[model samples]
Target chain A: MPEFEPKIVAFCCRYCAYTAADLAGSMRLQYSPNIRVVEMPCSGTIEHGLILNAFEKGVDGVYIAGCNLGDCHFLKGNVRAIKRVAAVKKILDEIGLGGQRLEFFHIPASEGTKFAKVANEMTERIRQLGPSPLNKNAAGNAQKEGGQTV
Target chain B: MIVAQQKPISEIAQMISDCKKVLFLGCAGCVTVCLSGGEKETDVLASAIRIKRTLENNPLEATTFTCTRQCDPEYIAGIDNLVKDVDAIVSLACGVGVQYLAERFMDKWVVPAMDTKFAGGSVVHGLWEEKCGLCGECILHRTGGICPIIRCSKSILNGPCGGSQYGKCEINKDIDCAWQLIYDRMKALGKLDKLMEIQPLKDWSKSRDGGPRKSIREDVMIDE
Candidate 1:
């Protein structure tokens, strides 16, 4: 048997989180490779349906990284994203999907190290939670992908 | 406009638990303006149900159709073919739409997804408050546009009632006494003299007390 490695999908805003990801790469920062980043023009564009669809697609964890409060390129986009994230969290909780599986972070464009930290933290938390109940083959597949080490 | 709110997902899930295929009908009428039952709400509800059923291993097949207005026969007739294919239907319209759908498609199982609240308008982005009682009477002229029938906690006509104090009703401080509002408005309009004239007893025959009501326009009727 092999270890389980959770898949994570991160929606990053172009003005901040995306730039931080670029800086993290240029600075030779080491972060978990399990994260798959989707770039958005603004965090406000991230709708509640899109987050749920990602979970339905079998991702173990999902998060939205947007500009810090009052720092959004489009004035109040980050604030709107914050409220939307809260709404999605409540829906997730109602549908028996634990709300902890989704998260939102306010990150400035200068915080490359913080971006790397969030990736590692989310990876660790999801690893502890194991495979998502929505993913029936997730555990067996994770073992297969990790190779025979256990 | 009529206001409504969606039922809890657990109750809705239980209603169609036995069914494999279900159709979610959305209304583009009063429920749409109230933000309770519309195209967006229908999609959200369908997605939630799909996720719940998928997790339970039942894997429901849900489809959505939003009609122009469910209260009218013409709009409901447009979905005759789709309604024939589903085992059950979840209507996201006001109470009127739910009944209309059931009446039009006699054989299909139709259930309501929202609780018809009141005749009101939005006070803010997501909040709504009742403003009318639909008592089959029009007396806004005498009451200064504040409806004692609905807004008043006690529905006392020509009264401050013993419960009114400091412009608020005693039932709940958050609620303003309707008579007080009427009095203030009438004072501003220099119509305080109108309050001295006694109003006649209300005619209950015109209200719900008269039983189920209907409005007919014989001039617009077409012989079939």
Candidate 2:
């Protein structure tokens, strides 16, 4: 069986995680290239769909990196984002994806180093967890039980 | 506003067994504001159904649309042109809209995609709690806008019962003691003295008990 490289989607808050990623770039920080970052204005503005959509599209792991609590550029945007992340975590559990696959991290604009660290850490973690059960060639089933798209 | 939550996609798919032509209807009023049956949810359901069909080899034809307000006769009339084609119409409105659809189109099978929770408003974003019991009574004037009937776990008209510990309900520590909230609000509003005003047991006879309830206003009625 060929080993699968898990596809990880990270929803990054534009003011915090995204900018921090840009900073990591300027500093030439090397991290896992598997993570595809989707930038949103504020973590709070990300409807639950974006996270679910990633998993629905067969992404092995999804993470939401938001502004540090109380530092949300839009007042309580990060707080709302936290709640939404928590909600999606439950949905992932319901859809046969073990809850651990989805992660929510709080990152401040100043924490470029932490962002790089998260990328490395998440990559290692997902490597150990293996591919999503819904992945086409994943071991558990030749295809999903119902072959449901999401 | 009437709030509802979408049924899990798996359950909704199971409900339409053998049905290929499905109509996904959304309400743009209360359910939209609450994020249940809005355009986003409509799209989500449509996508979920489409994906399931592709995987299961189930031939599915879904026509997605949303109305201004499912509960309003005028808004419902807007869908007259669409309902004629689908095998079943999945309404994303509350109980009212489901029945309204059935009444308007008795020949078409109508299924509810969302469950009506209660007459609650958002506490934060996504979290909702019942605020009005709509017992056909108004006690806000006396309670300082806090509803003891719906907020309190016991629906205690007069309370903060001994079960409350540190202002949290015994039922669930996460839930705020409704009586505690009411007491605090009334105290802050300088209406603590109002607690002494006893409220008689609610008259259920005038509520939804006897039959279908109705309200009439002689002043507002038009007479030929």
Candidate 3:
């Protein structure tokens, strides 16, 4: 049997994690290719519906990376993001999707090495957890249609 | 305003487990103000149900719609077209809204997503406290704008019950004795003499004990 590779979606704040991702590329840091990044103006802009939408679209794991605590460019955007992430985690847990599948991290823009590290860490963590139950059938269908597993 | 809290997702999921498709109706009224049943809550609930049913292989198709105020007939009338297509409805409104919607669409199943809590206001963002007892009477003027009917654990109208100690209710130490609040307010307003005036026996007929009640304004009635 071929190894299962999980699909992970990361909502990265433009002020921090997005810049960190760019810096990681320039620094030639190696990271897993499975992470798909959606750049947002601020972490506070990541709504509960957007995270749920990602799960609905068959993503195995979701993470929000934003500026470190007390370091947000918008004063309290990261604080709001933390609360939103906690709220979404509770909903995910209640819906039978383990809360472990979702994560929130504080990262500085200069942490290019840390950005690559999180990508590989999240990819590995999700791979161990396997695919989201919501995506089980969809993954099967995709393999049947595309003649390959994503 | 009416305050409410959402029922657990597990209980909600169980209520509509037999349903393949459901419409989550949100109210932009009291429930919205209390942060329980509103547009954001409606979307969150729809997504949660979709995820739960999908994992179970039952695959629920959930749709969401937010009305101006579910308790108002005019607002609910606007969603009649959407209601006809769904098998069941999960109304995210106060008890009044849920019953109103159910009565309006007698043939369809309408279930409440929120548990109507009380007539209250927010103490702060994300926190609400009961303030009114809906006793069908107003006595705030005599009590220095503090209500003893609901705020008092024992509903004592005359004075603080013997159970009050250190200005806290005996029922819960966290709760302040309503009479204490009234006394303080009365003192601040120089209306301490009002407490000496005996209150008359409350007319129970004006409240829920009088059975289902209605208020009609003859001037607003339309001739047949």
Best by lDDT: 3
lDDT of 2 at B29: 90
Worst 10 residues of 3 chain B by lDDT: B153-162
Badly placed stretches (over 4 Å) of model 2 are: A110-113, A124-150, B3-10, B42-63, B81-85, B120-205, B215-224
DockQ of each: 0.55, 0.14, 0.83
lDDT of 3 by residue, A35-76 (tens): 888999999999998999899888888999999988899999
TM-score of each: 0.93, 0.69, 0.94
Write one digit per residue (lDDT tens) for candidate 1, span B98-151: 999999899988999999999998889889999998889878889888899999
DockQ category of candidate 3: high
Q: Sort by DockQ, best first.
A: 3, 1, 2
Which stretches of model 3 miss by more than 4 angstroms? A136-150
What does candidate 3's lDDT look like per residue over B1-224, in tens digits?
A: 99999999998889999998799999998988998999999998999899989888899989999999998899999998898888899999999999999999999888989899999999989999999999887888889888998999878788788998999999899999999999998998888998898778888789888998888999998799
Q: Residues A1-150, candidate 2: write the lDDT tens digits.
A: 544456677889999999999999888998877688888888888777676666666777888899887788999988887887787676555544667888889877788898999987887788789877545544432233322232
Lowest summed lDDT window (length 10), candidate 1 chain A:
A141-150
lDDT tens digits by residue: candidate 1, A1-150? 566887888899999999999999999999987788899999888887788888877788899999988898999898888888898788778888778888999878899998999998998888898877876567665755421221
Give the winner by TM-score. Answer: 3
**Deviation in Å, model 2, residue B72 alpha carbon:** 1.5
Sort order, TM-score high to low: 3, 1, 2
